[model samples]
Target: MDRDLFRTVKQGTRNQARLLYHRLVCRLPHLLAVTLLLVVAPRLVSTLSLAALWSEARANAAVLLAACAGCAAAAYAYAMSRPRPVYLVDLAGYKPGPAHEATRAQAIRQFGLAGGFDDESMSFQKRMMERSGLGEATHFPASLMSIPVDMCLQTARDESEAVVFGVVDELLAKTGVRAEDIGVVIANSSLYSPTPSFVSLIVNRYRLRHDVVSHNLSGMGCSAGIIAIDLAKHLLQVHPDTYALVVSTENITLNAYLGNNRPMLVTNTLFRVGGAAVLLSNRRQERARAKYQLIHTVRTHRGASDRSYGCVTQEEDDAGHVGVSLSKELMSVAGEALRTNITTLGPLVLPLSEQLRFLATVVLKRVFRADVKPHIPDFTLALDHFCIHAGGRGVLDELERSLKLSAWHMEPSRMTLYRFGNTSSSSLWYELAYCEAKGRIKKGDRVWQIAFGSGFKCNSAVWKALRAVDAVAVGDTGSPWAQDVDVLPVHVPKVVPIDDDEASYKTAAA
Candidate 1:
């Protein structure tokens, strides 16, 4: 009892100290100004008296006071003109219920029986999944294999509703923020949209206010999550004291590639069912309760280049089988996109020393025409954590090499891919949840989330944690990895052979 009381007292004291520090930091400019005035007031008065210029001194003092008043007014105006702080109050990832779980063997069996693929296609898909870095536990719709091409509407609606409702409901429940309070709604899904649109569906389902602004984004691919956040940030900046809800997801059932085109088949093996809903607020009242502050968002589009634009394209193959084809040039295009994105984001987040070095390298390369390669500023110097999109094994490997991230740093992306597969835009959120579940995030730590998408686009969102958060306290039960998080970072082999019967069947059919 005595030890418990002592511990409580110590914690209270620490909390008080933290409060005091925040107060001082917020009022630092005012404190400095007051200190300067106190230090100089006496000397100024003495000097004026010694000069025997009382009348002139009084006149000068009046002018000086007027100037100070003008300056204060200007400062207040500038402060008001600045954008309000945007906070991520809370976020939730949709973990499809047990009914949707698809084992690798199940996926193979269903594909075989569905008659969507020939022997060659089946073998290729099996090979792709084996090397795809996705585990047997990845979620897929029960109707995926059974849904006919003409009945795509059912699959689209079912998948969209399941993910959208699951994530938004969880987010609202966690934050206790009513749907009516959400003034802006932005929903992004690469493949599916009905007449009402996904955003309208959300607003209608949640019974949001009549005035709620809604937008539905499509064709934005895997990076759409960051893009949606960027859109929300802008909307919140323009409309003050309002809540914005951003939902990122992809309709895998509707977009699933069933064609024999090898490039297009890749998407089938990579993408899985997932979605994330994030609640952002610019309200001053919620600052203390918010989990993270949006520090920076940068987006770059290299679509002007023909190769970059064509790297990831959705179209019908020669046989009229529609699918998204990922070209071999995707990695190189993505690398260029990332390089361009980081160039814009570096100045805002990178340390002064790193910036100076990068600037020097640029100068040498451009001005002197030297054989100097431009430096990639060490992003680790600016961010405590990185949530790179878990698009695929090759994407993760390339990013790990490009960013100079260690195995420990790349663990979240790798593990998220293994657990959930590529959830399109929402993949970053799953990666972030992985970090949180592992207890890697801490107060004041800055996390950088970077994503690449089908527009030949790369985008980034940097977040600073507002307060300490424990994975347990946040309740990880809703996460796909919640049950097995403790046993994660497990070795996933580069390839796993298909069952002996399935292999023989494929060989005979060929």
Candidate 2:
């Protein structure tokens, strides 16, 4: 993002304007729903009158009026809340050293010989390590690169429950959040379906107050992180002055695909060990204490019936063999999903100029059918920084073009991919941390995070920094990873763009 863009947003109550716009946007859907009701209500009422149903007609009117009033009140309350993310903490734990890379290549080669090779390579692994400053671990194979069965909950049913609880314990220590104060708990694990479930394990482990609202989400892919954030946002509104903990991670052992399909290979090569716990609250008192504030969230899902939903999928063959696969058309599906998500999300956060441009194009294309072209989303207007989904270099390239994002706007996300490999759901947080390390974040700066998942889902969370980090957080072992990130490859370093098809690698001993 350009400094001028940030300056412009701050110049004349633009933040205030953006907030009002979002409040209205939130009500637009409900308003449209009610409008449909209005169109249908009169005719239906008259039809019922023929049956002498006067009381039912009056009751329907009352219900409609009440709903409209409630929506208005909710919108007003949200607009007045004025909550912003305090600071974003991106985790860089489980940094992949060199050994991980060799392991992956070995796995691919061995699997390929048995027709189990989806051609999952160490290319992404190498890029992730170099970007993250993780020297040798990038070469480690899936066997070593992946989390232990115990960690991803691959053991007995009880064991899986125990693993998630153990992680929650670590989370409590990291955030210093007590069990009693937590008003909401959201856990997203797409693979393993343990008995008591992921959320239940966390609540039980912490012995959280019995009244705490808990939600467990499964089946959603990497985008589950932001979906979890949205869920927390709503819970905050329902119970103000309460804490909500959002936990996101994939069960590596469960989702791991051992097959020869190319799409499945992408997953084996990209995903690695990672998990994150975020603390969110709408309470004014918690503002100064919170790490990151909830500015805004947008979720767009192409249903299971949509083409994009099958773009990235796992299925069993007619013979009953199970495996994950990525279609050659996955990128196109992702682009379409992004188009829908941005169309809905951009208007709420972007500036007047960008919105007008977008709107004008829509009008020209749809109404006049003029010889005008559609405009790519102007993300620069809405955010000072961006954590583009690090699904892959190809995915990033497509988004950069689609959103018209500058290279700097993509740096943190790219660097995050380099260091963390795709840590699945937690990758966005790590990318945000990279931006903070680069000294790009300032007080009141807006950060946009976009993540794509298996359902061909696009989920986005917009955050405004309330304060800058005074110093790097204690848990960020990747700090050393960021020390000389500008030049990159601080040790025996060699760097290249991930999209460079011609780039070659020379093996080095760790």
Candidate 3:
């Protein structure tokens, strides 16, 4: 036993010595290089004559001069080739009057009294309302409030005229931009398109120049605002030193679904009246006065796929009543669109370090076949503010969790939902307005405005603020939240379950 112990100890010592010898051998070149750099390098430098170094520099003068010239030329060429920046000079979100304000209780009582919805449909609407995160202050068009709702082109026109004129007047007033000076007008609405396009409506109302670039985009739902911004950006890029007006509105007075289709009825409970107008310019003179400079606009359209195209659509029910159907596949389709949009946008906006981390994760998951959860790139690192479209409470909830955003980051969207309900394409602007109203927008802050639309499209609009926006939380600043923004940043409960019993619902809504 003593001999065995002695042999084991002798073997362990031999193994340690052998390992140490190998380590020293492996490090020999590095040690020698370090010694030369620390000791021999200084002595060599001391021994070197100034005349020799001067001769070397003189010999390489032509090459050094040529390299510097080449670098300057390259920089000049890059500067000239850089894309012109698009500036958002000012923007306005329509604030409906007190007559338009519709509480959730009002919706319940009015819809119930209207007798349009059967008991089952009414019950579904109540449930949706309970979870919708809407406060008692959302608006509905006056046309919608009429006892027997007037569904006519005239009524729709009235609604559109109100939204379009309201926002445009405010925007024009704030910017002090003249009608004829407007070089381009791009208007977007999902459901209501008149014979004279919305662009024409703006043009005729403002008496814009005959040569003005005009377009009316239709059937592009809630994401249309970003899409309109994208369109305006392109137009501004081409039409140098010009102002472009982009109007986004959806006339919900025409959006009421009288049908009992459960899927279609969701619209009745969620959709509300709202609109926005934005002024964009590519003029160099406008930079100092601009609120934000457009950095990037990315749009992902999944309409080619049948499932995505049909996810949210207007169709006649079995009984021949027309309504918009919010399919079960809608969220999944939106998710797919959002995934594609963010992936494309990630490379543009994410910092180099973040991009590298995301790339490494992709490599690990795809190339290495490692067992790992899919990496959700931390967007908060790249963006200072997020104006996620407040389409509904569910959408906000899903994005908050998926994006790993804090409550502060989501406050704008949530408060918008609570205060304004779902304003469709203009909802994103309402959210942005909330931030502006709160004086949260600071100079150099990068804001990411993301929205999902009915063409099954996901879109992103990125901006960098020029200066801090003042807290315009009162009067008519064209912000829907301006009137009540001070009382906001309210604590919205995770779930406010309402009673299912019919009698209890009346009291709950009240």
Candidate 4:
């Protein structure tokens, strides 16, 4: 048995070596170029130094100079060919009125009675909501509990229009940019779309120019905001001096599951109505007025793996009620996705010290076959602020542990989850608003926003603050957290018990 195990291990090592060799062979051109510069170039120069070859020295010098010039031009072109700078000129988050705020008791009573959940399902949802870390102020659309169930469309429309119109108007007004000047309009929503599409609605409502390019992304879950930003960045690269308006939102009313499946039930407890609008410009003149400059965007998708692909998915339950389900392995899957994303992002943003340390560990393990644990780079050193996804309490806890982050570093995510629950793709913007409302973001500060979504995907966006923004400047009308900004960073208990009569009755029935 011992001999067989040793043989298996040796075979695995050989296979890995073969794979590495194939990869290196694919990069042979780059390796050959590097070898010419380091090895052949110096030897050629030295050989030309002999006085016997003085006559040929001038030709060799010209050849060497030409090679050097070619290399410099290639490097310059690679740098200049990169996408143009995309600036976040201004942004706004939708603030729902008091009528939309739903407390735990309210959700328990309203959803429990209206959703027609069985006693066991109600009990399970009650427990889930208690541990959700959401406050009593999370908003919900009025159409969520319509008696006839036919009002879902109207509810979705009302909710989407309110959020889209409010945030876009606020963004345009704040940036002083005309609607007609927006060259690109991208809107993403995880649920519900009217015939004209959300992007079309924005164009019509704002009277945007006929030539404005527009796209409406549907079914891309909570990470769609960053994905939209990535799309806009690419568009700006091709279309110079253009403005891209990205609206990220999720409509909960139509997507809300009225089923008994525990996984589906969790969505109803966590997701709430919210939206955000971000104005991105590639025009150089807008840089001085911009609030933040987009620096890096890294996205990782693990959909090929069955476990990750099914981690979060929308499917019909046994009774034919359709809803998005959160799998038991969601946290683990999300952690893996985040690891993949940061692995790519670390080299781009991490300081030299951290990069060297990570490189040393990787070299030791790969080349020396050292039995060393892989090091998680100190991302805090690379970013001043972190807006991790507010997917749920467990998601936040896992990220904190994986990234070795402190409580203060996680304040924005925590507070956003507490105030807004999981607003899907727009949650990161809400967290950013919270940071801004608290005056935590300073000029030149690097803010890193990470999001995990249904594709078992992790996406990250890094921004450098262009100018200082004071908390006072973030008024109640400007930010969803503005009204209670001063009272934030508050202690949110892990569990808030439901004390309403309905909850008591449900407990008695159970």
Error of 1 at 152 (Å): 1.8
Q: Which portions of model 4 show Cα errors greater than 4 Å?
A: 1-82, 145-151, 362-372, 473-475, 501-510
In candidate 1, what are the lDDT values of residues 72-124, reduced to their tens digit?
99789869867789999988998887788888777777666555577788888
Runs of candidate 3 exceeding 4 Å displacement? 1-81, 366-369, 476-478, 497-510
- Candidates sorted on lDDT, descending: 4, 3, 1, 2
lDDT values for all models: 0.83, 0.63, 0.83, 0.84
RMSD of 1: 10.8
Tens digits of per-residue lDDT for model 4, 72-103 = 99878866765689999988999888888888
Clashes of 3: 0
Candidate 3, residues 282-355, lDDT tens digits: the string is 88999999999999898889889999989999998887878899999887787778767776677667766775
Positional deviation of 231 in candidate 2, in angstroms? Answer: 0.6
| Model 1: CA > 4 A from native | 1-47, 50-72, 145-151, 359-374, 473-478, 500-510
1-510: candidate 2 lDDT, tens digit per residue: 234223322332454467678778877867888999999999887776655676765669988788889989977976766443333322223333344344333433333333332223444443443343222233222433333323234433433443345455555676666779988889887765677787887877778898999999988888888998888787776786677887776555555555444445566656655666676766676667544566778787776646776777778644454656778888877876776676667657777787667557656766787777666656776688888777776788778787777777877766666555676777787677677666667888888899998877889988878777554544454353443345542232335334322122222110
Residue 411 lDDT in candidate 1? 88
lDDT of model 1, residue 257? 69
Model 3 TM-score relative to the real fold? 0.82
